[model samples]
Target: MTSVGTPPAAPVTAEAPMRRLDRRMIWVDAIQMVISLIPTVVALAVFKVEPRPQVIWPAALVAVLGVVTAVNDLFRWLKTRYRVTPDRVEVRTGLLVRSNLSVPRDRIRSVESTANLKQRLAGLRVVTIGTGRHASAGEATIELNAVRRETAEELRRLLLRGADRPDDATVLAELRWRWLLYNLVNIWAFLTAMFVIWSAYWLLNNFGVELDTWVLGLADWEALGPGVTIAVATAAVGLIGVAGLVIGFVTEFWEFRLTRVRTAAGTALRTTNGLLRTREVNRDDNRLRGVHIGEPLFWRWMGAADTAVISTGLAKAGMGAEPASTILPRGPIAEALRVARLVLGGDDRPFEAPLRPHPRRALRRRVIWALNTTGALTVLLLWLDLTVEALPGGLWLAGPGVAPVAVLAAVVAYRALGHTVHGRYLVTRSGLLTRSTDALDRSAVIGWKFRQSLLQRRLNLVTVIATTAAGYGRYKAPDLDLHDGVEFADRATPDMLTPFITRIPPRR
Candidate 1:
C-alpha cells in the first residue's frame, strides 16, 4: 500500500511493526452480539402479549445486523496493518478499496485509549491517534481496536516520547465526587434523557405496546383535570431525565483528570475521563485560540460553569460540542479561571480586564428580534386556535405568555452584550441563559469580516467577526457602534483593517 503521504514508498521498519489488531477482538465481537440482543430479549419477556412476529422479526433483524458487524470486524482485523516510525504512525486497511491513515509525530494532537468491560476482560484496549485535523465525525480518529494493554501503553509512549514538556507539567484539576452534581444542571443531560424517553416510546409504540400505561401507571384519566394530568406526565418525564443524567455522568466522568504539561513543543493539555470506556486526549497549548466559558442559567445560579478551550484540530464530538477544548468539566467559576490561566501559560489579564458594553441600539435590536420571534409564535398559535379544532386551549394562552418571556430574554441578552481588547486577547462576552466569554488570542486571528444589516446601518451598528483557523473559526463582537467596532478590529489586529476601512469626517 501507499505511504501516509504520496511519497514513492516507505517500508514497515521492524522498529515498530506491520501488525493487525489483537486476536481477542473476536471475543469482543462475540460480546457485542450478546449486548445487541439484550434489548430485544427484555422486550419480548416484558411484553409477552405483543404480537410474536413483530417482536421476533426485530430480534432476527438485530441478529442479522450483528452477524454483518461480526463478519466485517473479522475481515477488518485480518486485513488491517499498522506501523510506527520516528516521524509518523500509519495504518492501512481494507480488502478491496484500501485506505492509509497516518499522523505525523509533530502534527499528532492527541492519542487516546479506551476499553469497555469485554475488552478489559480480554486484556485489550482501543488506541486512537488523532492529528487534530478538521474532519467529519470519526474521520480524525485512527483506531487500533482490541490491542493488548501493554502494546497500547507502549504505543502511547512512542507517540508522546519527545512531545512531553521540558518543564514539569501542572495538575490543574483532579476528579471530584462532589463536582459530579454539576452534570445534572447541564441542558445536555436533560436533552439526552428526553431523546432516550422518546426513543423508548417510539420503539414500544411501533411494537404495538402503549407506553402511557408504564409511564403514567394506571391514572384515572376522567377524574384528573387536564392540568393535573399534564403535571403528572411532566413529573414522570423529569424523573426519567434525572435517572438518565445520573447514569450518563457516572459513566462518562468516572475518574476524569485534567493536566497541563509544558513540553518542548508547547504547553500540552491532557484530559482523561469516562468509566465504562475510558478516553484520554492531548492537545498543544499553542493551538488554543481562546477559552470558552459557559454558564447555563441553572449552573450560574449554583455558581458553577463549564470551560472549554477554543482550539483547532480538536474533535468537538462524542462528549459535547467542543470536547477537546473542555478544561474544567463542571466546576466553580474560580476553578475554571484557574485552569484557563494554566492553559494560557499564566496569562491572567484576559479574565481580569473590564469589558465594554455595547451601544443602547444593541439592546433595541435584541428586543426587536425577540418581539419578531414571539410575534411569529403568537400568530401561529392564533391560526391554530382558529383552524385546528383539536388544538389545546392551553396552547393559545401559552403563545401570549411567550411575550413576557421574550421581553425578559431580550433584557438579559442586552446585559450580556460586551467585548474588550486586553493586550493580546480580544474578549467577547454574550448569551443570556448560557453566558459565554471567549478570550481569544489576537495573534491567532487571520482575518476580519464586518457586516451591517439595513437595521444595523440605521442604528450605526456593525458586527466585526475575527476569523481564525482555530476553534469555531469566526468569533464576533456583534451589535457595536460602527466606528467602535471597526476601531476594535483594527486595535485587536494592528494594520490589518486599514485597507478595508475608509473614514469620512463630518463637516462642521
Candidate 2:
C-alpha cells in the first residue's frame, strides 16, 4: 500500500503461514447440501410426475458433479496452509490449478474475517486481504475453515504487523445481533408497507371500472379532484416502505456474523471479531480519513447511529466497493465515536468554533430544486386529473394540492442545506431530516479545493473540499464556511496549532 503522505517503498514482505486456514471447510459445503436438494425426493405426491428413464442418467451425472466438487474442496481445505515471515505472507493452495500467493507485510491494507452460521458452529473462518486494488479478489487472500478462535487472532496479529497494540485494539463482536435487529426494523417496515400495497391492489381490482385503454393513455390532470390523488400517493409510499423491509430482512440474512480480529498494525479497529471471509486493508494510508454519521430519525430516537467511512477502493466478490464505510457502522455516538477514535489514533481534536452555511444559499438551492419538482408534479397531476374525472373519487380529492406540495418540498430541501464545522473538526450536513456530516482532523488535510460553476462563482459561492487518504471521507464546506465567519482557508491555520503538521501534497 503506497501512502501519498508517506513515501512509497518496495513491497514489504509478510511471513506466509504454512496453513493459517484449516482444511475442514468441507463442513461448510456439507451445510450447503440442505439447500441444493441433491437427495432429489422430488415432491412425488404433489407433482405426480415420475422421472423419465431417458433423463435419469443425466440428472444423476449432474448430481455426481456437485459431489465431486465438494470432495475436491474438502481435500484442498485439508492441505492449504499459510505462514508469515517478517517480510512476506505466503499461501499455498490448489489440488489442480497449483498456485502460490505471496503478499508483502506492508502491502496489506487491513485484515478481516467471518464465519457463516455453519462455519461458526464448526469454528471455521474466511479471510480477505484487501490489496487496495480490484485485482486481488481471488483465493480470499487466506481462508481457514474450522480453526480455533485463538488461532485466528494469532495469525491475524502476525499478518498485520508483528506487535499487537493494546491501545489500538478494535474488535467488534456484536454485529450479528445488531445487524439482525436492524434487519428486523426493515422487516417491520415491509409488513407496514404491505397493508398499503394490498389496499392499492384492492382499489385497482374493485374500482378501476369502465377503463378504456385509449382514455387511460390520454388522461390529463385537469379532470380529477385532489383528494383521490393524495390517497393513491399515500398508498404507494406505504407499499414501497413495506417492500424495502422485506428486502432488508432477506439481504441481511446472507452470511451474517460478528467478526473477531487482532493484528500487528497502525490502528487497532481493523481487527473484527467475526466475518465470513478473511480481509486485509490499509489503515495507516487512511488514518486521517473521516466518516459521516447518519442515523435516521427513527434510529436516532432509538439511540442508535449508522456510521460509514468513505474510501475509493473498488468492490470485491463479497467485499463491498465501500466495505470500510458500511462495515464501520458503530452504535450510539458514544460507543461509535470511541471506536472511531481508537481506530483513528491521530484524530482527537474537539469542536471549538462552528462554521455554519449561509441561509440564503440554502434557500436559493431549495427554490431551484422546487421549480424542477413542480414541473414534474404538473405533468403527473395533469395526467391523474383527467383519469379521475370519470370515476367517483375516494378521498382527499384539487389542482392547488400538487403545486403547493411540490413547492413545499423544494423549500424544505433548501432549508435542510445547513452545516456546522466546529474547531478543527468539520460536520457539514445537508439533507431533509437525514443530513450527514464528514468528521475529520483539519491539520492532517493534504489540500483543499473550492469548486463552482460560473453561476455559483458569480454568486460568490463555492464548495470547500478537504481530503486525506487516512480520512474515510472528504469534508465539504458547501455554500459557505469559515470565510463568511471570519475563518481563514490556508495550510497556515493548521501549522499554527500543531507544529508536527506538515504540508500534504495534493491528492492523486
Candidate 3:
C-alpha cells in the first residue's frame, strides 16, 4: 500500500472523474423483490378463481412491488455518485434530499468491503468507510452498497494510504481449522439453541401439533427414567448448540488471513475472511491505542484467547458483534499477545507490569456485600414460606448456600484487580469468570474521574476511571488505595492528575 500525503483540495476535474455504483444493482434489487413476492404468488395460486378480483389482487401486488423496487433502485444508481481525489473521497447521493459526504484521507480509519455469494459472482461488493464517529447510518458515514470489487479496492487503497512507516508489511497470523473448536465454548450459542427449542415447541403446539407426542415425545421418560431422560435431553441440546457455533465459525472465518502492512503514513492492519460474505477490513495503525485480550475460563484452559485492538473507530471492547476489531480469533494466548504487540507498532514492552493492588478492605467490602445480598434473599424466602405455607423442601437452603458461592467468586475478583503504567500504556486487568486485560494508550487519556462509595471513602480507597473518546470510553481501576491511585494517575499522564492532589504536612 502507498503512503499518502495531505493533498490540496483538488476539485472534481476531467482527470479525476466521478463514478457511479454498478449498473447490476438494479437486478439485485429486482431479485430481492421477487423473493419478497413469494407469499403473494402462493396467495394468488391458492385463491385462484375465474373473474375473481381478490385472486388478481395478489398478482397486482407482486407486479407493483417488483416494478417499484426496480425503478427505485435504478433511480438510486443514477443519483449516487462518488469521486476520489488526492486528499479525500467525496460522495453525492439522494434524488430529493441531495446529501454530500466527504471523508478526508487522513481521518479515514477503516475501509471495509463485504460481498455475498451472489455479489462475489458478479464482482460487486458493499464498502463501508469508517471515520472515528460512532453514530447511526447518517453520521457513521460512507456506505457504498453495490460497487465494483476493483473500484472498491481502489477506493480502499486511496483512502487508507498513509505516510510510510520504517518497517515493511508482515503476515501476523493465519486462520487454523482447529482453533474454531474454541468458538464452541461461547455460552451464547447454548442459550440460543435452548431458546429456539422451546420456541419451536410452543409454536408447533399452538398450531395444533401435539409436541408431547411428536418432538418432545421422542424422549421415552417412562422407559429411560428421569435421570436418563434429563441426560439425553441435555446432550441433544448441547449438540444443537455446538452445531450452531460450528456453522457460524465455519462461515465467518473460512479462509481468514491477517496481515500488517507498512504504508507511508504508518502501519496498516488488514484482515480478510468469511465464506458466505467475504469481508476485508483495513485499519490505520495510529488509531490503535491499546489492545484488549480476553481469556474465557474454558478457552483459557484450552490455551486459546481472543484479542481485539482498542482503536477509536471500532466498536467497544468485548462487543463481539464487530468482527473487524478482532485481531485474533480463537488462537493460542501467546499468538494473540504477539499479534497484539505487532499491531501496537512492535512495542513488546509488557503492559502487564507489576501492579499496585487495592487494599485488603476492598476484599472485605466484597465479602460483606455478598453475605448481605444472600441474607436478604434468605429472609425473603422465609417470608414467602410464612405467608403462603407451600414451598419446596430444600428451596430455602439454596438461599443460604448462595452466600458462600458469591463470596468465593468475590474473592477471586478481588485477587484479579490490578493496574499498572507500562511505557506509554495504562494497563489494567480484572474480572473473575472472563478475565480481561486492557492496555490503553496514556496519550489517548482525555479525562480522569475519581469515584468513591460510602464504604470506599472510609477505607481511603477510590475508583479512578480514565476516559477516552474511543472504544468503551471509560476504563476503571477500581478500589485502589487513595494515595497510590492518584500518584499512579499523575505518573500515567504528567500534570493531568497532579493539580487535584494536595500534600498535607505531618502533625506534631
Candidate 4:
C-alpha cells in the first residue's frame, strides 16, 4: 500500500530501542488459563465422580493443556518486541522461528485502543493498528496484546499523528439513555437471550445435571392449563430477553461519544465507548468514503436507525466482529442523519437528494420471484402432507396465508429501490427488512459493473454496480431500465464508463 502524508518530525530510527510488552500480560494469561480450567474442575465436583482412569484422564489432559498454553503465552510475551520509526511501525516475535512485520506509518488508517475487564483492572490495554488492507491469510492489522493504558493512548496519538486535545474538535454524537428503548425491539436481543439460555442448559447437561428435568419438575403444566402456562412462559422469556438487551446496551455503549478531531495529516473521527470493555477508535477522515444509514424494520417503525461509515480497509474481519466503521448505535433517525451530514462535512444534499426510483418492471420482477418461491414452498408442504403423511393437514393453511405476506414483501422491496447522484456522492437505497441509504464519494468509485440475468434482460432491466474499495466493495442499483442504468453509472463517475459504453442511435 502507498503511504500518505509527510513523515513525522524527530523520527525514531531503526536503531531506536524496541519496547517489550507489559510483563503483567504473562500473569494475566495465567489467570485466564486457570479460569478456563474452572469448568473442568466444577464438572468433576458436580458429577461426584471417583478418580477412575476415565475421570482422572480428562482432568489431567485439561490441566496439561492449560499449563502448555501458559508456557506458550509466557514465551510469546518474552519474545515480542515492537517499535515505531519515522516511516514504519515494526514488530518482531517468535521463539523457534522469529517473525518480523512492518507497516508504513502513513498507511495506517485506524488506531484502536481497547481494554476488557481483566485488562482494565491491570491498567492495561490492547492496541490494534489497521492499514485498511486485506491479507490473503491471517490478520491485516497489527496488535499489541497488552500494554500500559498510558502507553496505548500515547501510541494511538503517535501513530495517527492526531492531537490529544484539539481545540476545534467537535462532538458529533453521544449516548442517550432513551436510545436503550430501541434495543428491546431488536430481534437479535431475543435471539441472544435464547442462545444464552440454551448454552447454560447445554453446559449443565454436560456436567451430568438434569437441568431440563429439574425445570419441568418445578411446573405443574396440566393444572395451570396449556394456554396459561404458555403465556406465563412467554412472559418470563420476554422479561429475560429485555433484561439482557438493557444490560448489553448499557455495557457496550455507556459513555459513548463520537468526536471529529484535527490531525496532522487531516481530520479523523474518534469514538469512545464501553463500560466493562472500553474501546476507543480513530478513523482517518481521508479514508472515509461514505456513510451507511441502516433502518431495520422494527427500528424504522420506531423512528430509529444506526450509522456506519463506508471506509476503505475498515471492513469487519469475520462474522459477528465489530469494526471501527460503526459510528452510531441504534438511535433516532434524525440524529443518524445529523451525524451523517457532519461526517460528510457538508449540508443535507446527500441525505435529502431526490432518488430516482427503479422502473416498474422492477416491481413486476420482485412479485414474480416472490410468487414463484411461495408456490414452490407451498407445493413442497402439500407433497409432504399427501405422500409422506408427515405434516398435519391444517399446516397447509400456512401456504395460503404466506402468499399475501410474500406479496407484501415484494411490494416493500420494490419501494426500497432507488439511486441518484447527489453532488460528490453516488446515493443508493435498497433492501426491505433493513433498508440502507449509502452516500458514497464519487471519486472513491474505482469502476462500474453492469449485470443482467435472463429475466432482467428480457425485461430490459439492468443492475448497475458501483465498485469501490470501501465497505462491501460494491453497491448495486437493482432492476433499473437498461438505458437509465447505463446513464446513471456514467453520470455518477464521469468518463469512467464512457470509453466502454456504446451509444446506439434511437429508432424513429
Candidate topping lDDT:
4
Give the per-residue lDDT digits (tens) of candidate 1, residues 253-282. Answer: 877888777655556788888888787777
lDDT score for residue 164 of model 2: 54
Give the lDDT of residue 177 in candidate 1: 76
For candidate 1, the TM-score is: 0.83
How does model 2 score by TM-score?
0.60
- Tens digits of per-residue lDDT, candidate 2, 1-508, equal 4543322232334333265455456756765654444334342234443655433544466467768867877777766766666656677777777778776655565565655666666676555555444445354344445466566666565555655555444354244445444433443564567665565553332222222443346545346657766676566565688566545444443343222234333343442332333333434334434555665645655556565554444233353333544544335655555544544444443322243546475466556656666666656666776677864443223334556665676675555454555555555565555555556655556666666655454455656666654433356656653244223345324444243223422222
Full ranking by lDDT: 4, 1, 3, 2
Worst ten in a row by lDDT for model 4: 499-508
What candidate 3 gets wrong by more than 4 Å, as runs, is 1-18, 32-79, 93-99, 136-138, 162-168, 191-222, 316-320, 346-348, 380-397, 503-508
CA error at residue 350 for candidate 3, angstroms = 2.2
Compute the lDDT of residue 343 as modeled in candidate 3.
70
Q: Each model's RMSD to truth, in Å?
A: 5.1, 10.6, 5.5, 3.5
The residue-level lDDT of candidate 4 at 207 comes to 67
Clash count, one per candidate: 4, 87, 9, 1
* Ranked by TM-score, top first: 4, 1, 3, 2
TM-scores for every predicted model? 0.83, 0.60, 0.81, 0.89
In order, what lDDT does every prediction score? 0.78, 0.51, 0.75, 0.83
Q: After superposition, how far is residue 21 of candidate 4 from its true place, in Å?
A: 1.4
What lDDT tens digits, residue by residue, belong to model 3 across residues 1-508? 3435564443335357788899988788777778766544554455442425643555577679789878977988999988877766789999889989887656677777888877787788999887666653346658887899888876676676633343565788898887877788777777867877776664444334556678556655797788988788788888888887888888888888888888656677888888978777777777787888877765667877778887877633222346457877777787787777777764545454686677898898788888889999988887777677577555667788898899998898898788989888888877777777888999999998888888778777888899987677778888888877787788889977666567521112
